[model samples]
Target chain A: MLRAAVEAGADAVYCGFQNATNARNFAGLNFTPKELQDGVAYAHTRGTKVLLALNSFASEGRFELWKHAAECGADCGVDAFIVADIGVASHLANQLPQQRLHLSVQAAASNPEAINFYCREFGIARAVLPRLLTITEIRNLKNEVDCEIETFVFGNHGLMVEGRCSLTNYAVGVSTNMDGACSPASHVRYERDATGGMTANLGDHVIDCFAPCDQAGYPTICKGRYRTPVREEPYYAFEEPVSINLMDMLPELIGAGVDAFKIEGRQRSRTYAGQVVGAFRKAIDAILAGQSPNPIDLIGLTEGHKQTQGAFLTKKWR
Target chain B: MSITPLAKLTLGPILFHWDAAAKCDFYARIADECPIDTVYIGEVVCSKRTPFFERHLPEVIERLERGGKTVVLSTLAEVVLPRERKMTTELCAQSDYLVEVNNGAGLGPIAGRPHRIGPTLNVYNVQSMVHLASRGADHFTLPAEIPGNVAALIGAAARPIGVGIEVQVFGRAPLALSARCFHARAHGRSKDDCRFVCEADPDGLQLSTLSGGPFLAINGIQTLSWGYVNLGAELDAMCAAGICYFRLMPHRTDMVTVAKIFFDRLAGLSSPDEAGACLSALGLGPFENGFWHGRAGHLYHTEPEH
Candidate 1:
């Protein structure tokens, strides 16, 4: 996939080590220490940079693990470490001052003041902005802060506050901020009722239900269907399972001072990532070449065959 | 006689919006009647709602100060706009007042200056706590879902500077925040023209699952626990664990009486049993302290699961 991304015109590719060191802590994904070394070698040989994600919040006895991951990642010749925890950032800034650091979107640094603090404290060169900021806000943030700004342009338009949410912690007994897994598969259950309706659950809590004719969405816990009197039909109580597609607003994003674009779903299969990566690569190239940034068809690739402009295009306050 | 516990009752910043008159009346009552040691005044949840309440702030602060309580201003949890930045910067620059920062975005203005760090800033361990302490924060409200043992560990590291640790002992523990407004989306209203509908739910609008189980509450950009987390049972141990301040997040309840119960219990006037019994009348939701016991945050554990 790294090679595929490279061949498809991706400037950088992010991957995680095969441990609790990253957010996508599924069973079969992520690289081992040896695999990380080889992956970095492969990306570098193909003229691409590899980023190591160490975005989880390090708690009481778990600080050493994050520190070790950084050392090992550096040893593996990765370009930078994407961090969120204050301790990890402070540690990396002081211990490995020469290494590059990028503030993960999980840091929730939506404003320049937060971005400035990260840059000052951790010596971070870039900050991955949260999925929350609007394009206008992004432009304002870029003017206020000195660091490079990256924003999510595709995948999982999460409605819950990332890095601060405990909905998963309240259910699955796993910390999304600390453990890096949101609604881990071990605690998930898909139950089918006699009426041919499917219910998705986190632990014992019912998240969403789908009828026979309805397309079932991923049980992300937050994006679950719910009952509310304000609305007639059973609706997505928090957010619809719509993947973000900013391709329609690429020119505006570029004009809004975005330094780079990010794609979520590192846990997905290689082919899925490569296809999305290729489409986005073409769109970005078209925009940079002073041509029309044509909207590439990506609906079939989306989670629910639906997409949203998300918080970026929406007016914030009424 | 035993030394007074000095366990202060604090009124955390209001995470909801009511009419300015309602807010002013609530604060007037707090100043005149409540036994809260400190009152956090400011709109912490949304920046747009601040204007409606800003005019009442000076008088409210005066009344609270005259009533012999400290008043702290809070910066927004999610800082995105230029106006919000200016507001946070000006608040941080004010030396006459103490500002509680809910995000790292407000840190620059308060850097090397006295301030309070709110729960949303992510102080999980001793290292993170000490790091923030070195940057001039004197007060830390451990995040809503932080377990007791972890708070104790962070508290021990806070001793050198008299950096007092605080915890939410009452009201619905705010679980998360988002840039998107779920409340507006529910009413088929856009965020820009929603007409501040959250004012209707003085506490918060309850959101339940399709199975009819109460789940979360929508408080504008904030997502709160449907269950009001009452820590009356854990107050004794929490106070003993270097937690000096107990914060009651403002909800639509008889806050003054609620303060009295916690105050009485802290002063050894009321039993934990009595305080626990008193909270039932507030008619919030179920009591849950499982987060303190290292279990799922939404569950109330009678005994340690482990």
Candidate 2:
């Protein structure tokens, strides 16, 4: 993706170690220490920066690994560290004072007051705002917050409050907050129903199911289909199977003073990553050049082959 | 050896909206009869609902104080608006009560002042605990879904610093909070025009799975576990690990009896199994203590003999 991103005129690329250090700790992905060293060299040579993603919450006993992740990237001359846990932030602030820190969306620092706390104490240069914030809220937050604000512009839409959700933890033993997986494939069971439907079971519970020939999404408890006995209908009570595509909302976000555009799906393949980065790259550059953002045709990679502007387009309560 | 404090029963701030009369009547009962040692009084969920119950705050505090229960006021979990920020600031400024911070926004408001940590703020690791301790936090309630061992480990780490730890031993555990009001959305209303609909479900409106299984509850901006997290059986384990406070989140049930069961189990007057049965008889949905075993929080596994 480094070459693809640079070739696609990207200014920066964010990736993480293959271990449990980042939020998307999928199989056969992320970089080793040597790979990171080489990747940083490669990206820096092309005037494109490489930011290390150590965004997962690091709990007790595993503090050393998270701390090592910070040291590993800092030694590799990486541009910045996207951190979530206060423990990880504390380590980066005290030990690697020179390394620039960006508060991860996993920190859930939505409001300016909360974001400023991290900036004042941790010296964070940027904060990836939680997807929960509306454009108006983001615009309002930018006026008061100290650090640069980043918001998700495309890819998977996580409806739950970032950093604080336990819906994954309750149904599955692992959670993104504690364990770096949400409905991780290890525990997910796909079974064929008598009616020729596929049920995505997270452990013992059926999170969501799909009819035959219907595209199925990863079983996340919040975005799953559910039924209340009082209501005869089974619907996506929390959120539908949709990826957020904010290409149409770029100017509004830019006007709202969003410093960076984050593309979700580090869990996707490298080819998938490059395509998304390249697509968003063209759209953003066009917008920057005072031209209308040309919509990128990338719906095939979406959860249900559908995309939404999500909370961005919603008229939030004043 | 460090002194392990006897786990005292405490009542958390009411998360659901209740009318002033019912709210007063409930606190009156808690103040008059319940064996809880502490009572947290204030609106931690929505700031708009605070005014309806604000006038009765002093009387409730006075009544609880007279009943020999320590009362602490709690700030809202999420503060977005300018008024919410001012409200949070004013809540922390109160000289009469020590504010329990539900969000990090309160930390700045209560700077250098002794405060308590609510479950809404993530106090997962020892470093976060130590960080909050340095900022004048005297007590903490670990998040509802955190592993029991992690809570105990945090409690142990906090003991030396003179900070107390609390575990939510009962009630529908608060699972998540959002800026958007899910309760309002379920009713086809925006948050501003919510019309106080959350008051209808005193326990909270349960969100179920496609299989007709009750999964979670929607209480305005917060999503809660449908199963009341009754750790009556695990009180022995939590108390042994230096937890000083046992928190019971208020629900529309016979809480005095609920308190008695936990109190009896803690006092050695009843076995945990018996306490569990009595708690089950209360009929507040299902019960879960799976978080204690470090497994799926919704799944139940009997405590294996250590």
Whose DockQ is greatest here?
A: 1
Tens-place lDDT per residue, model 2, A1-318, is 666666666688887998888987777768899999999999988899999998887767677889888889988999999988877888889898988999998887767777888898799999998787678878989999888889898887877777788877887777677777777878888888999999988887888988999866788777787765335577666677889888888889888899999887467766777788888888888888999987778898787888888877765531
Deviation in angstroms for B157 in model 2?
1.6
Give every collision pair in model 2.
Answer: A226-B209, A226-B210, A227-B209, A227-B210
Candidate 2 ranges beyond 4 A from true positions:
A316-318, B1-5
Give per-residue CA lDDT, model 1, range B13-64, as digits (tens): 9899888998888988999998888999898888889889888788889999
Expressed as tens digits, the lDDT of each residue in A1-318 for candidate 1 is 666677776789888877776777777878889988998998898888999999888777667888899999989989988988888888888888889999998888887778889888878899998887778878877888878989888888877768989888877668788778888888888889999999888887888888988976678877887777677787876787888888888889999888989887576767777888888888888988989966789888787899988888866422
Q: How many residue pairs clash in each candidate?
A: 3, 4
Q: Give the interface RMSD of candidate 2.
A: 2.2
TM-score of candidate 2 on Cα atoms, chains taken together = 0.95
lDDT of 1 at B90: 82
User: Using Cα atoms with residue i matched to residue i, what is each candidate's TM-score against the true structure?
Assistant: 0.95, 0.95
